[model samples]
Target: MDTVPETRIGWTFLTNHARVLTAIADNPSVRIRDIAAHCRLTERAVQKIITDLEEDGYLSHIREGRANTYRIVPGKVLRHPAEAGLTVGSLLSLLVQDESERSPQYAHVKQ
Candidate 1:
C-alpha cells in the first residue's frame, strides 16, 4: 500500500487565523471539526486559533445548548501596521471564494 504525501505548499495568501475566522463567518454555528477540515488543520490547531482570536478580541462565542454561535467583530482593525484602518470585514471579503472559482475550468489566477 502506498500513501500519498500531503500537499505542503510553502504559503497561502491568508493565515490560518484568517481562514478559521472566515469559516466561522460563513457559518456561525459551525463545529470546530468542520473548520479544521476546511482549513486542513487539526482539531487541536483550530481550538488554539479560536482561543487566540477570542483573546485578541476579534471573536466571541455564546454557548447555545450543545453548540457555539460565533460572533465576529467586523469593525476590529487588522493587527499589522501596513493594514492600518483595514477592518475584519475587509479581510474576510477578500478571503471568501466566489462562485466562478468553483468551476472546473477556472484557473486561480494569482493576484
Candidate 2:
C-alpha cells in the first residue's frame, strides 16, 4: 500500500505586513497568538509587523490591561505612487461588500 505524502503550501505574493493588517482590521483587539494562527506566521513575525505598522502611522495601539486595543488611521495615504492621494478609507471601501447583501454572519458582525 502506498501513502500520499503531505505537501506544505507556501505563500506567493502576499506579504506578512498585509496579513497582519487584515487580521487587525477584522478584529481590533485580537491577540498576538490569534494573529499568528490566522496569518500562518510566528508570534515574533507578527510582533515585528505590528511594530512596523505602528511606527509608520498606519495603526495606533492603546494598552488596555493585558490586551492591546488597536485603532486604524483610515485617512493615511498609501505609499505606492500608483496609489498616490488614496487613503485607507478608499481602499477599504473597494474591499468591503454591501452589508445588506452579505451573509448573516457578516451582517450580524456589523450590527
Candidate 3:
C-alpha cells in the first residue's frame, strides 16, 4: 500500500465501500464526482463501488431527470461474518454525522 508521504495515514479503518455508503447516507442526491472528491478516490472507482453495493442489495438508486437519487437498503445485514448481525442502518449510524453535529469547531472534540 502506498503511504501518504506527509501524514503517513496510509490506510483507514473504514473501507472504500463504507466511505461511499456513508457519503450517500449523508446526501441521497449527492453526485458521483462529489463522492469521489470527498473520498479522495477516482470517479471510476466510486462508480464501481456503487455498482457493487447495488448488486449485493445493500443500496439502490432512482433515476430523477438528470441526477440519480440513492436509497440505502436499511436493515440489510452486512456481508462479513464478523459483522453478520449488524445492519446497514447501524453501520451508517456510526459513520454518517448530522450537519449540525459536524461543525468545524467540534472537529477535534471526542464523542
Candidate 4:
C-alpha cells in the first residue's frame, strides 16, 4: 500500500517574507496569530517579518481599536533585478487568485 506525505519538503518557491505578505494581502485586518497560523510561523517571527516589510517600505499598519488594519504599498517595486518594475500589486494579484477563495473539492475528483 502507498501512503501520502503528511509534511512538506524543506523548501519552496516563495520565501517566508512572501508568504507573510501574501497572508496579509489575503486579509488586511488579519491578526498576527492568524497570520502565524497560516504561514506556519511563530507569532514573533511574523512580527519580525512585518517589521522588515515596514522598514523596507513594503507595508504599513494602523491600529483600529484593538486590532491592526494593514496597508500594502502596491506601487513599490520588487527587490530582484529580474522582477524589476514589477509592483507589489502584480505579485499579490498572482498569489491571491480567485481560485484560492473557492472551497476546494479535489478529494471528490479522480486522479
Model 1, range 1-111, lDDT digits (tens) per residue?
012236576976778998899878767778888778667899999999999999999999999887899999999999999999999998888865665553321122111
Cα-based RMSD of the predictions, in order? 7.8, 7.2, 6.8, 7.3
Candidate number of the best TM-score: 3
Better of 2 and 4 by TM-score: 4
> What local distance difference test score does each model get?
0.80, 0.71, 0.82, 0.81
Which digits, one per residue and each the tens of the lDDT, describe model 4 over residues 1-111? 012225487878899999899878767778888677667789999999999999999999999788888999999999999999999999999987475464432233222
The candidate that achieves the highest lDDT relative to the unseen native structure:
3
Cα error, residue 40 of model 2, in Å, equals 0.6
By TM-score, the candidates rank as: 3, 4, 1, 2
Task: Give the candidates in order of lDDT, highest first.
Answer: 3, 4, 1, 2
Candidate 2 lDDT by residue in tens digits, 1-111? 012225348745546776678667666788888778666689999999999989999999999877888888999998789989998767756543455553332122221
TM-score of each: 0.79, 0.72, 0.83, 0.81
Number of backbone collisions per candidate: 0, 0, 0, 0
Off by over 4 Å in 3: 1-9, 103-111
lDDT of 1 at 101: 50
